[model samples]
Target: MYGDVDVPAAVQRALTGFLDLQQERLEAIGPELTEQVQAARDATSGGKRLRPAFCYWGFRAAGGDPAQPILTAAASLEMLHVSALVHDDVMDSSDTRRGAPAAHRRFEALQRARSEVSGVGGDPVGFGVGAAILLGDLCLIWADEMLHTSGFDAAALARASKFFDAVRVEVTAGQYLDLVAQASGVSDMDQALRVLRYKSATYTVERPLHIGAALAGGDRRLIEALSAYGLPVGEAFQLRDDLLGVFGDPALTGKPAGDDLREGKRTVLVAYAVDHASEVQLAEFDRLFGRPDLDDDEIQLLREILQDSRAVRACEDLITERTEDALDALDRAPLADDTARKALADLAIAATSRQL
Candidate 1:
């Protein structure tokens, strides 16, 4: 079941410790700025810490010492992820995150309270969004600063920087594709795969692994092998997330059921269902997709339609296929240690098997 890979207890400690270090750095910047940064930092506290863990394990897999520098660099990635989330929540107008008030919402509350006390009308939404945007930018800048100042050798720093740059570029491209597809709809499997590669796979898994490996002085061949394993696994992970967004229990996922349906995410599952659906089903989809006002019963019916159309089965099959591809790549990779390999394998399983 769980704990299939004996992840080093020290590694886990290092991850948290690095996070604390970054928090301290953020707080020290200024007392006036501390509240915003602290809010941003608190937003990240409850995640699975998957990215940092991946970075740590990837470094260890390449025989790098889990020293201060490595731990700091790994934590930096977590900060970057937080930055992305702050911006994403604003973009999505999400009210909650990790089962709590989203950053912008929290700021909105603060603004309203201040306005009521002062008897003035301040644009809460605008102020909240502006603050969130700045906070996200600060996080990105700090992530780079932390990575650069981690005392790695110049060569290692350069390599890691290049890898981070690639990650940023790929993730931006992926996000653009996601937005485009949401607007235009994905017509075929090829376009859907492109979305998967750019939006989720490269940033979520491949680049994180590569950055860790690069920091540890891994050879190009090793990095390439890790990327191969990461791509399909990451895609599978996102696909599972897509399913959960539509079908998962709200208590488990910290989101309302059918949030994805409301959001109109052009996921592979939706695309497959639309392609295979009958005319009536297609009409129902067109009516419900992206409609925020749909009631619970309507959402339930949409789920039923998805099940009836066998899109659920098709998505599950794709998960299986992608998981197998990831494992196959791992089998052929020239990993140096059994622990690292086992951890990667367990991660692949855990990522797709998650209920929330």
Candidate 2:
């Protein structure tokens, strides 16, 4: 699926170089800025480079040659992704990320320690939240900066910038929609799906492809085909994630066990379960699901209900259906060669598969 390009390795090198340069600039500000830069470095570490892979392949499929500028620009997508994750962790009040303390949690812990020593900072959690918000904003700005400084000519950058801008808006709107759905405590499939498409579908896959394609000066035909392939794949990707969030090993997922259940994520699976639930099951589900203090037995019981409701099966079907749709579209896309098509097909499978 990777073709000749080791996308993850290449992006890692690019990110390392970029962060090093960023650190130099931060040094001019103050030595105390060391932690901030380290925080950024840590956040960018251990990513699957999925977004960057999509961006790289999109450029490749559009007939773009391997170039240094593209690598830096692709790495910027990771910055954007990291930005989203930091803010998302804050929003979800997640304790861990990538199997370590979440950005906000890290900051909170730092503040708590400092407050204990000096007795200065009040409300350590709030301090952590504020710091994480700044960190997310910093990454967001870095994403734009990295792209603009990627050494691409103005024309190509201009072309790609449109999609980059659009993706930012789409992901933010999607996140807001998700927040609304969770707060409303309504498990409507249509609403959940809307949240899915906007939150994950467009930003994660479709726009990354579009940005890369545009950078390569690909025509509207190529852009449409990429979306035709990318959107369904993106939806399937999130659907798989929904299942994992509920049922997968927390250690593997780098999240608290049943965190999604505790948070009451209004995913399509949840919607399906709710729609098909019996009266007594609904009552129990409402009582136990989303309770922050739900015990192990309650968690197991929720899992059983999800399984018995057949929502898991429905979600699995949707993943298969969307993956097939993506592969079909990729087979028909006007890619530069068969290699790109095969790589894309491979990515589709990886995105929708159960593996983390």
* TM-scores of all candidate predictions against the true structure: 0.91, 0.98
What do the candidate models score in CA lDDT, each in turn? 0.79, 0.90
* lDDT of each residue in 99-172, candidate 2, tens digit only: 89999999889889999999787898998999899999989999999999988999999999999999999999
In angstroms, the error of model 1 at 83 is 1.3
Prediction 2 global C-alpha lDDT: 0.90
**After superposing candidate 1, which stretches have Cα over 4 Å from the reference?**
1-31, 185-188
- Per-residue lDDT of model 1, residues 105-139, tens digit only: 88888888899999997799998888888888877
On lDDT, the leading prediction is 2
Listed per model in order, the count of residue pairs whose N, CA or C atoms clash below 3 Å is 0, 0
Q: Clashes in candidate 1: how many? A: 0
Residue 221 shift from truth in candidate 1, angstroms = 1.5
Q: Please report the TM-score between candidate 2 and the true structure.
A: 0.98
